[model samples]
Each structure stands twice: as C-alpha cells, then as structure tokens.
Target: MSMNGREKITNKKRLKPAKIVWQVIVYLLLITGAIVMLIPFFWMLSTSLKESFQVFSFPPKWIPDPIKWDNYVLTFNSLPFGKWLVNTVIITASTIVGTLLSCTIVAYGFARFRARGRNVLFLVMLATMMLPSAVTMIPVFYLFKSLGWINTFYPLIVPAFFGNAFFIFLLRQFYMSIPTELEDAAKIDGLGTVGILWRIIVPLTMPALTTVAIFQFNGAWNDFMGPLLYLSKPDLYTLALGINFFKSQNDVQWNYLMAASLVTMLPSLILFFVGQKYFIEGISLSGGIKG
Candidate 1:
C-alpha cells in the first residue's frame, strides 16, 4: 500500500470517536427529555395512591404506605362515573367516524379533482383555523339553543359530520404523494371516481386515517367545555364534566380527583400507544406537499 493510503486509513479510524461522541450526546438528550416528561405522570400516580394527609406532607412522599386502592373505588362510587364513561365513549366514537368519512372525501377532492376556484375554497377553509373557539362560542351556543339541542348530544357529535380543516389538509398532502399514473390507470379500467377512491385511495391512506381517528378520539375524550355548555343533565354528562362536578362538590380532594383523572386518561393513552406506528408514519408522510 502507498504511504498516502496508510495515512487515510488512520484518519478514518480517528473520525470514529467523534461519531461516537455525537451519538452519546443525542442519547443523553433523549433520556433527559423522557424523564422530564414522565415526572408529572409519576407525581399524579403517587398522589393518587397516597392518603389525603400524606399528599401535603413535609418531605413529599414518593410512595404511599398502604397504597390507597380505595381511591379508585371511592371515585367511582361517589358519582355515576360508569355512566360518564359510557357517554364519553359514544361521543368519541361518533366523532371518529364522522371525521374519517368527511375529512377523507374532502381531502380526496382537494388532492385529485381539478376544478375552478378549488384553491380559493381550500384557502378559505384553512383561514377558519385562525378563528378561535372563544370568538364563535356565544353564537354557536345560541344556534344550538335555537335548534332545541341543549342538554342533548347533538351539539357534541353532529358538527363532526362536517370536515375539520386541519385533518383535511393532512390527508390531502398524503394523497398528493401518490403518483397520478395509479389514478389514471384506475380510470382506464372503467372505475368511477368514488370507485377508485374507495378501492385504491382509501386503502393506500390508512395511516393518515388512523392519525385522524386518534386526533378526533383525543379531542372528543378530553373536551370539557362543549359538554359543560350543552349537557346540563347528570345522566348525559361526560367524564370531563363529571370530574369537574365532583371537584366542585367534594371541595378539593386531591387523591380522588387524581384517581378519576387517571381513569379518564387511560383510554387515550392506550389508543395512542397502540396506534403510534401508523400515527407517526401518517404525520411524516403528510407533512409536505409534492410537485
């Protein structure tokens, strides 16, 4: 071997340590971030298991002695928690279905259909996202009241049947990534627009749909204001409203409230963990537009 080749090999060997150092730095940052995020959840769990007295103790107990299993029981027994859970499930399921159906069809049109004024309509829809809920809250409330929809689930579930701007945009970007040739070939085989969408486009975009479903599920499940405004009856109450009512009546019981919060949070946590693969893939694929 030449002298220059021997020196080049030595230089490559020296570069390996720099690469290792950067990798170690990245790993340390990730671990620090993970710990920081988990601290609040850990504290909540610990507080739930503790006695009321132990919650505010001087040193702050990280573990409870008896590990109050009864907090969960008391939380359920104090109110109609089971009924609240059922109501939340109904609202969440309806939103997921409505969002997926409406958003997918709208996005398909925006991605594929060529029509005049299409871009204007899309920009108008996107502009709506800038309008905060506070701006529309009073008019929306009055509209529902005029429809005699107060104290019913109609106000909560019905609006999702229309498309959401953000979900439509996400799905549209994902749909644009597919080659136009596939769509053209489908048409050549005598497939109608709806037929092609259902048979080919829908299957290809399941990841994006899963992302939409998870987002809707989280939004509906955690929604407190919508139910508080519309649902006055205890029987029709969702977990979010019910938990607030419990807090008000009980006069601030931390252990019980934490337990209830954890129960309310479980379904969302489970759904995200289960759908995370598709959820992440969908976000990445839909994050940009293609030429």
Candidate 2:
C-alpha cells in the first residue's frame, strides 16, 4: 500500500476511538447531572408517599412499601387547604398583573424617554435592588400599618402595583434592546409615545413581559415572610403561611408538610414549563441590555 493510504487508514482508526470516547463522556456527564438535580425531588416524593416513620428512616428508603396516599387527604382535611390555595391564587394572580403593568410602564419610561436626570434616577432605582428586603421590611410594615393595610391582602398586592425595582430593571434591559427605529416610525405615522408603546413595543416585548409575569407569580406564591408579617388573620393566610401554621413547637407532621409543599410548588412549576419559551427569550433579551 502507498504511504498516503496507510496514513489515511491510521487517521480513520484514531478518529473512531476519539468519537466513541467523547460520546461516552457526554452520556456520563448527562446521567450524573440528572441524578444530582433529581435527588431532592425524588426524596420529596418518596417522603410524601411514605408512612411517617419511613420518612425519617436512617438508611433512607427510596420507595415506600405501602404508600400512604391518605397523607394528601389528611393534609387538606387538617387545615383550610382549599381556602389557602384560593388566597394564594388570588394574591399571585393579582401580583403578577400588577407587577407587569407597573414594571412595563416604568421600564418603558427608562428605556425610551430622554428626560433630564433619567439616567440618574434609573441608577438610583437599580441601587435599590441591592438593598435587602429584610432591611426595608419593618419600614414597609410601618408604612402599611399607618395606612391600615395590615391583616389584609393589600400589603402583598398593592406594593406590586407600585412596581418592583429588580423586575423593572429586568424589563428595562429588555425594553432597551428593542430598536428605537420602530418607535420613531410609529411617531412619524401619527402615533404618540403612549400609542407606540401600546401598539408596537408591548406586542414585540410579550416574551419579556411573560417572563416577568412568571417570575412575579412565583415570587408572590412562594413568599413566606411578607405574608406571615402582613396577614394576621387565618382567613387571609397564603399557602406559605398556611404551611407554617401546620408546624408546632411540640409536634410536626413531616408527611403532611411535604405534601403541602409539593402541592404549593405545582402551579409555579406548571407556569414555568408553560411559559418556558418566553422565559428563555426574556433571559436572552435581559442579557443584551444594561441595567
């Protein structure tokens, strides 16, 4: 055989082994990552289905022998689970709507307007995101108290209508990424700023808006501290606060608590999966802007 033909044969043999090695490596990494990410959820499900004793077993049982399907029933029966779920749904939905409307308006102003001190104000708003919620909790509580909003859903829902700094910043970044030429063209066609924003920018930014809605929904739904602090009445308690009420210093129901948690997480999970396309697009747009 010629030297060139021999070299070609050797290269082919080397390439086959390298391809196989890379394929094996990829599969190994994927399996390892899958196991790591799924372990917590698997544990949660196992505990939810297991008898109370099996939940805290030293050896850690992956599967329950006789699943206690009754735990879910017991959890709902023990508390006003239905009512709590309803309250959470109402608050979450209201918060999402309010946040989106308020944040989009604020973000549009920051992204499109050229008012004096606009950049400075935007920077100040961005700086507020760095301030911990814990730091402002007491002040906000006091402010709401003065307004007699305590023990009502107002504290949770009303603030959302005022806009959240972080969400506003996220949306502003996305808004800034939208080309200015479109707005200018609309202006030339007798569309005012508000008209252009409503007819053009908002429709174009639906993905980012949906992303903001999803995040706000999850945040409001999962919020424990704010609801716990604001709502003193059991009737107004959100799902998070309701779950806390299930626990006592003397005794606790691990199975029921886990079941409740699993239930509470379902809506956010469903929303995320449903809005994943818009969420991904929003994230991409967020990365494309400044502040």
Which candidate should be chosen as best, given TM-score against the real structure?
Answer: 1
Worst 10 residues of 2 by lDDT: 282-291
- Go through the candidates in order and give the C-alpha RMSD of each one to the true structure: 2.9, 4.0
lDDT (C-alpha) at residue 116 in model 2: 98
TM-score (C-alpha, index-matched) for candidate 1:
0.93
Quality of model 2 by C-alpha lDDT: 0.86
lDDT of 1 by residue, 1-291 (tens): 999999999999999999999999999999999999999899899999989988889888888887999999998898799999999999999988999999999999999999999999999999999999999999999999999999999999999999899999999998888878888999999999999999888887877888888889999999999999999999999999998988887468899899999989988889989998884554553533244
Candidate 1 regions with alpha-carbon error over 4 angstroms: 282-291
The residue-level lDDT of candidate 2 at 93 comes to 90
Q: List the residue pairs that clash in candidate 1.
A: none
Q: What is the per-residue lDDT of model 2 for residues 186-221, given as tens digits with 9 covering 90 to 100?
A: 889999978998898887777778778877887888
Query: Candidate 2 versus the native: TM-score?
Result: 0.87
Q: After superposition, how far is residue 179 of candidate 1 from its true place, in Å?
A: 1.7
